[model samples]
Target: MRSTSQRSVVIIGGGISGLASAALLARDGYDVDLVEARDGFGGRAGRWERDGFRFDTGPSWYLMPEVFDHFFHLLGTSAAEQLDLERLIPGYRIFFEGHADPLDISASATENMERFEAVEAGAGHRLERYLDSAQRTYDIAVERFLYTSFDSARPFLSAEVVRRGPRLMQLLLEPLESFVARRFHDPRLRQILGYPAVFLGSSPGRTPSLYHLMSSLDLTGGVQYPHGGFAALIDAMVDLARAAGARLHAGTAATRIVTAPGGPGRARATARGVQVRDPAGEERTLDADVVVATADLHHVETTMLPRPLQTYPESWWRRRTSSPGGVLVMLGIRGELPQLPHHTLLFTRDWSANFGAIADGRVPSPASTYVCKPSATDSSVAPPGHENLFLLVPAPADPALGHGGEDGAGSSAVERIADEAIEQLGRWAGVGDLSDRVVVRRTVGPADFRDDLGAWRGGILGPAHTLRQSAFFRAGNASRRVDSLYYAGSSTIPGIGLPMCLISAEVLLKRLRGDHSPSRLPTPMSPSPSHRPPPEGTIRS
Candidate 1:
């Protein structure tokens, strides 16, 4: 292991990934500095308070508790002890049309199968086999693939990847709709099984079969929620980072990365530090041994880095649709709603036509809706005797489609869309005029996400999780152009969600610590003049 003195590091963007990196490195005895652009530190997955209602602005669901537990454990702490992680019983409910009862997904496979059987005759045994296949894929993937860094295809080109190639192909080749179609005959049952892929921003028919892994994560790991609010977990992580001796510069935006040639002979351009302009526009320079970017990959690649160090060209970005943007609604109801669970998915009857409209830049027909009733589980989120509800509807990230960008008039149009969506959800879910009962509410559109999070095209999760860009095929965790620059977040491997962001931090830390060398320092990237004499006399070897 490298000595502590050689490990001073700077992490850009105070997202979960950056904070995790800071906490882990500092705990390992490396001095760390964390910089964020916003007024707070949670990035897109942060929280906001308004009019007596608490809202987790991004990522309403926490699917994997172990990922958070493992991260905190690495820093000599336990998430269970620090944060009240409650296993959500029945986990979540799914609403499909023409069905007498909605399906409740339980933690146990046997119970879930029983529910499946109730929906479709003899589907329980078939679902068991389907889940068996999904679990196999999850076991192999979670163990060896998802946690790894793919600097190049070299790692995947190994004998193991070669041997496992067929299995991987088998996992993804059939397409989700086809696989689910073959398994169960009920339309509602198929929609329920295929609904998880919507989180990937792709329709079941278009999504790769490997997306079955999404179900596996939820089925195997179990869905959970923090006792207080999702923000509690963020607070705990920030505390852990601070305790590890990392200095956090909150409400600071990094304007640019200053750089110079790395090594003695001017071979590579190393990142010297960043030029930051705080919320007040006060400028400062933060120099460090390395720079970890946890911001949007496209933003960092195209705008932050100097032109020379740009690895991917604009054309490359143009070719990739990675993540789709959406409209999110936070609602505070004046009265309690009956029979609503902690989570619910109200899918439109015509799911295919809805995606087609989104693909064509028209308003999605029968738009899929996801609802979260935090008050169902924790009533403290709202005032006494009130309900706190959050709703999400996926839409195209680009503003040209009436999504609130390119034109300043987008928010108004988005509000209209939110109004329509709220009405539709109420009618479909039998919630009884939800829009009329709202005492407090807030609407977040694609443009709002872009303005707040600096998301490219208002994309929430990085790049679409398609087979072509999945796993090692996504953006590498390490920078191709800058020797000491790296990336960790949804845009990088293992890709998207809270758990993946934490795992990205682990991958980056391993690389930074493993590649240390004295000669790697003091390259041309230093801001001081090259003619300046070396500090002190060189005595000991």
Candidate 2:
């Protein structure tokens, strides 16, 4: 057994959560090494470049800027000093199928209210009231729940939860769609309020109303973008981990988790290290006192560890609702798209039908697509006369629904879906012959997620944030079946999103430091209501 001073840590995966965990552990005097299966460190936030165009492969939206700031600040600097962030004006545009004009959601409350008034009478004031209630929900959730590791029910018994008990019950018990419908008369308004639920990988009707806090983050908190691309943020995280004395190894896949010998007399099995394979197909064993898995929880438990050491079995995972996967198309276009904003959403006429198709393990044709034209905000991503575009369509994560057979035929199916998505996007944006302008194109699908990132069921977002699968009900940061083993990332506590990943690292660090009560962790600053929009013209449908 190694002494506490000589203890070393091994982290699996080089995503934001893994990097953050390595940095914090290294700073705490533990010798740390992080292994990533992919050639890059960003995981889903990976990047690609070709023909002078850079595309952020995943996570284009930058919400909850303060969470990033707090994480960087813990490493002895500020996010502002490490990265250049620009706030997007009129945050995004939502285009309905038959509506002549798209609804623009502005950062400023006054502007958004005016737009709402144009649709339904007295809707502007109603939005304000709803947002106010949402703000309260946001505050309570952030301060009391988000940063904590709910190892027990003690935290929920706090005075704050008691005082806000009624409100919490209302939010948790109601469905997001029902909540929005009760508050807004117009379908557009309801869609605007309910659309954010997609971020949690569930339809509004299935998602809990407690997630309405996302609306506050989107409307009042404002959207932000890293200067170059999401890749820059990944670079910052890598630099921070390196500076903190953590060694990072890309292109190395962890094949097995080595554990201490267990028998009838042994109390529990302990994580000893990891067996890994390099890019050259060379396998090696790296010993460590502790192992932290920041990869997919299901993959780690089922593949890396022995079956008997698994805390969650295949049956357990099968019952949990996996989040939906996405068909992502990255295109480097030869010309500009004037109709597309920095972020644009084309919603179908029947949102229910779209949701139903996805639930039934099928891709929705004429899908509700999200288009990100980064060149509209950051010119550095593309060549002088070109535009960088990313299109994402929410689809089922079932391997059976994928185009080809699970093993090798899925790529072809992915391409067909991408082509169909491009056609749909062109029709919505009124840009005929979109394929002619595409000089470069790449497509990623469910099988890509499963093969590349080891995502369970090719789910891009991990487990869905259903009432039964959130907080304490979700996977724990520390493994119960093995000693000296911990977990982080979207699959664990604090749930999905980049902000939650950062918070998950914080939770893990607190547990390691013997601070079992994570409610004591410092709260990140929330956005104020004073974020006014810069002067920019709105793009209508």
Candidate 3:
């Protein structure tokens, strides 16, 4: 192990990945400093409050409780002790366009199977068998893939990987839609099994079957919600990082990554420090032995580093597929929404057409949308008589789509889309006169993501998880052109989602420590029902 004497590191972006990295490295004896451009440290998972209504700006669904538990355990504490989580039974309600009533997806595996049996004969048993296979795939991937940094192929050529070679190959070759289609005849069941891919910013037909582990994570593993909101988890992480001896700077934006002077003989540049602008617009340079960038991968490579020292070029990013951006509407309503559940999905009947429009760089006329009413579960988000509603509609990330007003009338463009989205939500999900009931309203589109978080192409989830952009094929965590520069975030290996961010941080930590042993996969554990919500006024945005 390297000596802890006077070693210092600088981390850019205070997202989940950056916070996790800073905390872990500090605990391991490195002096760490994290800088965030935003007023707060959550990045995409930031929070906002207006007129007594609190909203979690991003990532409402909390999946993979085990990942959170394991991360906290690594820090010598437990997630349960830091924050309270409630398993969302009947996790979400799904509404098909032509169907009369919605289908409720239960948290219990047995209940889910029974619901499947109700839909079609023997499908329940088939689902049971499918989840069994999915569980095994999840186990293998968590053990051999998700936690390791893919610097080379030698680690993957181990005896364990060779033994599971055939199964792995099969998973890699098949598409998620094809895999689900082969098993279930019911379109709704197939849709349920395949829709999880959308969360990864992929079409079911384009995503690899290796991602079917999500089904196991949803159906068997379960979906959870933090008591205060998703932002509560961010608070927990920030508290943990600060407690571990890392200094966090909010409202400080990194301008560029500085490097040692280069000459003809120096083939590789060495990272030295970072130049940053503080909240008051004052600029300064902070020196460090190593730098970790958890910001947008494209922004870091193209804008932060010098042209000659940059590893990935603009042309390379242009060739890669980026995930779709979204149009979000946050409405604080006057009264309760009796028809809507805590989580609801309104899927268009023409799923193919919807995906085609997004892929072809146009917003679909009638879009499938997701709605979250957190007040249904926890009333603290809003006043006693009101409800907090958040609606998300997926759209193409093309800048020309007028999301951020490239045409000079950006606010009007956003208003037009918001009008359509509200009408659709009212018509499909039974929210009557949604526009008139709205007391507080805020809209966020592709331009918001680009301006606020510096997301590449205004994409929310980073690069699309195409086969070529996943696992070992994704961007390496360590920089090839700069020796002491590294990356950790949704754009790097192991892919997106909150769990992946945590895993990305761990992977970077192991690489920095030169410890390549496989991470012990934590067995999936059910959240205890005994936990209670945090006391009022405990967690702040």
Candidate 2 lDDT, tens digit per residue, 383-440?
Answer: 9988999989888996554542222334666767777888888877788988888888
In candidate 3 the C-alpha lDDT for residue 266 amounts to 58
Residue 228, model 3, lDDT: 95
lDDT of 2 at 448: 77
Give the alpha carbon lDDT tens digit for every residue of 1-541 in model 1.
Answer: 3332345577888988889888766665555788998878888777767677788877768876666767766766678778877777768887765554677887888888887888788998988888888877766676667766754455566676689889788767778889889888877778877876777756787778887867776665567888668787788888988976678988888888777787775537888778888778899888767788888888888888766688765667888764666777777888878757888887667877877777666667457778888878776688887888887877777654344422224467677777777887677678776778887767777766666777877776777777766776788877777877888988878787888899888777666655221111111122122122223332111
Candidate models: Cα lDDT each:
0.74, 0.84, 0.83
User: Which stretches of candidate 3 lie above 4 Å from their native place?
Assistant: 1-4, 261-267, 402-410, 520-541
Go through the candidates in order and give the C-alpha RMSD of each one to the true structure: 6.4, 8.5, 6.4
- The TM-score of candidate 1 is 0.89
Question: Which scores higher on TM-score, 1 or 3?
Answer: 3
RMSD of 1: 6.4
* Residue-wise C-alpha lDDT for candidate 3, range 1-541, written one tens digit per residue: 2233446789999999999998877776666889999999898898888889999989999888878889898888888998888888668998888888888897888999999999989999999998998898888898888988876577678898999899898888899999999999988898899887888888888888988888898798567889899889999999999987788999999999989864566547888889999999999988888899999899889989877888787988988988887887788889888788789888888888988899988888788888999998888899879999988888888544445322223577566777788888887778778778888788788888888888988887899887888888899898888878999999997888888999898888778877575674233212122222233333211
